[model samples]
Target: MAKTFEVNKTIKEINERIKNGKAVVVNAEEMVEIVRSKGKVEAAKEIDVVTTGTFSPMCSSGMLFNIGQEPPTMKTSQVWLNNVPCYAGIAAADAYIGATEPAEDDPLNKVYPGRFAYGGGHVIEDLIAGKTVRLKAKAYGTDCYPRKEIEKDITLKDLPNAVMLNPRNCYQNYNCAVNMTSRTIYTYMGPLKANQRNANFATAGQLSPLFNDPYLKTIGLGTRIFLAGSKGYVIGAGTQHVKNPARNERGIPLGGSGTLMIKGDLEGMDPRYFRGLSFQGYGCTASVGIGIPIPILNEEMAWYTGVSDADIQMPVKDYGYDYPNGIGRALAHVTFEELKSGEITVNGKVIPTVPLTSHVISLEIADKLKSWIQKGDFLLTEPVEEIEST
Candidate 1:
């Protein structure tokens, strides 16, 4: 019959044996490893018998015991057999140390520079206080698309047809300006000036405040203005100057009476304005001049189209057009030096060593770095400890 044992009694016996540095062994399962030497009759110390086993009754029973290697210290609470090393206690201590110690190289510890955004625009009008002055104007063109989308996959063949077709499309041109002093909306109209033949069409130099008129503000001195509206067409930013062709009524030169009146439209034009008329079109047209010739300005208008003031403000800068020139120039210099040293990379490739400028690093890259810092990723570590020379 098989013998039965009480579980509690067996556990108690085992614990008692462990306290006394004794262990019980059951039936031997199998042999592990063995080594033999040629000579017999020699001293056991010189006999050289090697064996692999979990535990050995004597040092000579295991090859590792006679290998002339010092045994690792085994603490009372630690356990090992023969000359083999056990790492359970050491690993447990290491885990405890790791849990209590702070990291030295966490990536979430860096500080980043501060940044901001700003924007502004202007509205031309003819009324002052509450007087209705005769406001005569003609809107000649409109645009309602972003330049990037317009330029993408575009060919010369698409140019003519892609031009905004509706000359009277209010969707193409309308903007709002805030009187910084009054904090009121100043509505303005856009569309290149179309009818120079209309006697009421004033000279380009004429100053006309759009909403509060009769306050003739000089038009040509590069006065900064702020225009704002829902369609992402706020302005008086980027470039702020209007040009005039020297011509009198009937499109004739003033002194030379017989000079032929130019019957053709001016090469570059200003969008026309209409009073008390709210027209429908893409908010894009409202934010940009329909006839601005400079492609950069046009591109700016298109890029900002359909963007909201709140959305725009959410970016690093409230107004991209308002970047500080000096800071930008300095950053460009630093970036250039870094590129020369192969410190910065783009598209997984090193940028060629060239003149450095803020433009070179790109606003996207700068913004990304700022974002990483904000999220506690790229951080500076504590200074490393120095080793003493022997």
Candidate 2:
């Protein structure tokens, strides 16, 4: 029961509904059930919009800081925030600290697995929470940029624009990983029990951005989004974005695809939504929360948003050692419904599934966003330019 519809005309229709405050908006998590039980045609007709959300530890996250000159006006060549290195390579007073950067003294995983106690992510968290961070930097003496070294305690309050401009955060589809090794390994995916004992997957199932719009039609430049509680936009295709990844029958990526580079004011973001996470055998990362709304521009867009969990598919990979390079012994073939059921059958064995991403929090985010759009506070946007697939 599908019909032809144009994106422009559909946007106008949705905008009119928004004006009257009667647009049918639903969280993507709920849309799946509605589509399955009520059929796509009926379900699409009822819901004019869908919002997707995700909260995960993204290693590709970091902060841009502008360390001020304290009379000395030092040129910061070497810098460390809370004993974690900040790339002073940006400018005299600016630096960026990646989430996974380790302490200079213990750069190696000598601590066995990884060091989670502190790193750039923790530093970013502390700064965002209004805590003071220790700063140490050394620079060669210059007449214009006179001072060569600086040591002091600085707070993000000193530099109000300590922004979060991540090159990457969310992924279209992620793998369900299990360890085949004898010993447990703590990783970004969380602790994977030895010998395929457990499977851990991230992403908010059907509520993920790229999964909801596999073609990147609605999500593009200038698209308003929910970022750590504050509003932001999709700046461009994120780093390492494999836009043309192979897709399954459902038009969902079999592995990871489309990524988004997002920008937002750190001062405006809620501290609760941005947290630092550490894995025992792994390192530290920033758990970023994000949400995006898709407008039902037509039955096609509505149908896309109404895609159920049972239709999405992601591969299961071995994480015992060589990850990403590990064999995808079996495809989960299960829907987001089965994936979230807390258990899934793999290799004919029913294995319990653990989500590194929080579905409960994600749902709450979606609901909060739906309320925003429903009240005329939030608006849908068509991307100014499509992300190039390379």
Candidate 3:
């Protein structure tokens, strides 16, 4: 189908409207109805920005910290913060810690469904919450860096450089997991009941960032976003980012697809938006809240932002068998509307479904981003380079 009219604008023009308090900004949820009622062309002309959000467990998250040089400036060969091992291969005092890195003594899955209460994710939360963590390091005792070992307590304020860099986040769509065997399964998607008694899935549905864009048209490198309650930027396409995943008729990806690499300073970060998650049998992860504002550049963008939960679909896979065996085939496909309704039918059997992501927080993030732009506190930036997508 062809559009009756074309509405076009630019980020500069949108920012000008924001400065003059004339830019109409709405969230993805509100834009859906507006586009349905006002039509795509008119909505594109009326709305200047559409904010999308997602708050879910992201395991590919970590932090880089410059803990400052020791008394004699020792070159760190091993680093541990709060008993969790850290990667010290960066610089003299700089180290990176991934969210999923477990503590050395943590009995992970050894007793079956271990309780991973503390890990790199918890350390990150503590730092952002203004709590101190024990920092320990060891050196090989070089001529210049004479210090062999050191121990100290450090907070986010104590570090000269603290940045949160997530490699893969904001998945476009994800799997709906189920267990087909007699035994229960604990996965990153949460727990699944046996015999397909229940299903678990993650994602913010229509309010998700990539779902709103459907393509990398508006979001790109250097695009500003509300990341974990701090101002952050999209660095590039994230790891395992499937640029051109299989899409349905509405151009929405069917399963795990487009992702973003994001970075932000740790200063002034709110702990509420950045939390440490301990998945029963799984190790640990971080729940990240991200909001991206899409500029209404054309009618196509407005139409894309109009996607609803009913328009989005995800594949269901058996976590006990297919997922564990590295199978990519989906047993069934269901829409977000059905998943959100708390139940879905699979193979003539009705099973309950639960969402692993928070839809309420997602809406709050969108609202917060919208308020920032409406108040002229947040401004959009043109991407330095477009993310490669076919």
Candidate 4:
């Protein structure tokens, strides 16, 4: 007769023995049976691996001893296995598993707005007598793209304020002019047009207006102007209305030529700004012209061109240079003694006629006038205000 043992008592004794030994050893046959049974139980408990079983403790008892006999399969095997918490099991059972999803308020998705970061060498320093600086022109983003080709009868007011190109004549002949209005030097595309109604005439589609009308006020003096395919020039005067247009030979029109017209303080052109392809082109050209050997763009150069807030102090005395009405006349007539004797130095410098810096121009007026000006075709008329003298 087969040995009859109490099931609960046998299991309890075996468990006690194993615990005392700190390890369990069974006869080869019994060991195989144990391993096979253990595997089935583990596989069933593993939600991802076992799909055809219900792992109830009662069902597990029959499976534990019937290792060799045909194993019984659970009725709701597929359903129960599929519903098991696999993710939770992995996280609880494995030490290596990590949280996969990111937090809802992650800063990685945030975006920053675009801005111009001015650095060292962005201004025109002293224009040594014979040194040459290459100026390259490139368009950034959709807002800066030059849409229209060169057009005839287009005046400075009719061009896109941001879309600037070298004047055909100016680049060809290297002749430049001082923009009296901005206090920056500008190289003329050619000789001033004798019969042209506007003093400054951009080749049919080559001209662009100042970036902003109000900002034009702060350009101040000693600015530089660079003509693409030519050398950089200094600003003798800022932007001004001339009686005639600067002229050059009517060479090929500069439209679609991918050239640039640069207007700023040459000192602002620190080597840092020349990092990419556009800057490299300018650096190459500048090297060819002036022999000032330097990389197209470097971090050191960028740091040099950036201006600090502390550097921008207001002048004590007002020179009528920035005013539209009598400032010009007032600027011209200030006696040397009066200027010298004044408490501040603002009244001493002669103000050239130029468009105000974009920052200084009124936004309302600029918005209304920009479209017409950028087209380089619209004529602007200032409304006269009737005033009663007090």
> Which should have the higher lDDT, number 1 or number 3?
3
Tens digits of per-residue lDDT for model 3 on 39-116? 999999999999988889999999988888747878899999998999999878889999998887776545554667
lDDT against the true structure, per candidate, is 0.17, 0.79, 0.91, 0.19
TM-scores of all candidate predictions against the true structure? 0.12, 0.89, 0.97, 0.15
Off by over 4 Å in 1: 1-152, 158-160, 163-166, 169-203, 206-283, 286-390
What value does the lDDT take at residue 90 in candidate 3?
Answer: 86
Clashing pairs in 2: 113-281, 309-336
> What are the runs in model 3 whose C-alpha is more than 4 Å off?
1-5, 107-114
- Global local distance difference test of model 1: 0.17
Error of 4 at 155 (Å): 34
Per-residue lDDT tens digits for candidate 2, residues 28-139, read 9788777778766676668888988888878898888788777767778888988889898888889888888866665445555465566777777787788898888899
Best by TM-score: 3
**Alpha-carbon error at 328 in model 1, in Å?**
46
Taking the tens digit of each residue's C-alpha lDDT, what string does model 1 give over 164-242?
Answer: 1111111111111111122211112111112110001011110001100111111111221111100111112112111
Off by over 4 Å in 2: 1-3, 6-20, 37-46, 104-113, 321-333
- Report how far residue 272 has shifted in candidate 4, in Å: 8.8
